[model samples]
Target: MSSTTHNHTDASCIFCKIIAGSIPSMKLFETDKVYAFLDIGPIAPKHCLVIPKWHGAKITDIPDDYLMEIAPALKRIAIASGEENYNLLANAGTIAHQVVMHLHWHFIPKPDEKQGLGVGWPATKPEKKELQRIYDELKQKL
Candidate 1:
């Protein structure tokens, strides 16, 4: 871990305040690199927010190391939430409904469409050739 990742807190950020023990939150889990807690305004029953301890405004700004470190904690929270199925969502920007500027991942235990995390994907059934072409293009870029 870099020195930049150590105990840094933003006074203006709510998540920072929560991490710094300034604001009260229903903490679910905590580690040196990450924090997990219940969302104050939950869309579902087991709605939890997992965030990096570092004050990252968006996914692009957060270190990849911290991002990788949060996976195990997320899995644990999902399993403990007691829902067989769940959705892991991270909105990057304002257009994506990221109300809080901190880099947080939402773990919503989805029992049904009506209850927990409701998703409306504008999916299209593309031709096999089109799919292959798109995949090939992405693979080349990668």
Candidate 2:
């Protein structure tokens, strides 16, 4: 982890306050490993956040156990939201516009075509040579 990343600011952190029960939330479900709560500022009607119990500034900073807990919690939220589809988003860093320092997953449920999370995909595709270069570069890091 980088030194610039503030691991957590418990007393001032909104997520920490939520986990501490100091902040009220529309509780959906929870486990020893995770907590699922309705998004106070929801993009969709059933938009919610699935967060690990342990505090971490970013996804890369979270422990393996906490990371592992996300999948099942996401599944539960999807079913509870009564949606067959969902959009999972995790904003990582300052450039990505991660307003909250705590690591969390946005599970935006979309039951209907019009009333759900709207996603925008880039139209451009990288050239084959560029793709190969990227693949090689990533593999080298591994």
TM-score of 2: 0.84
- Judging by lDDT against the true structure, name the best candidate: 1
**Model 1 misplacement above 4 A:** 1-8, 125-137
lDDT of each: 0.85, 0.79
Candidate 1 to native Cα RMSD, angstroms: 2.7
Worst 10 residues of 1 by lDDT: 1-10
Error in Å for residue 1 of model 2:
23
Best by TM-score: 2
Per-residue alpha-carbon lDDT of candidate 2 for residues 1-142, written as tens digits (9 for 90 to 100): 3112334336777887777677888878776667889999987788999887777778777779778989989887787768777798888887986889888899987767786677788788889999999999999999
Q: Which whole-number lDDT from 0 to 100 does residue 115 have in model 1?
A: 78
**Candidate 1: pairs in clash:** none
Model 2's alpha-carbon lDDT is 0.79
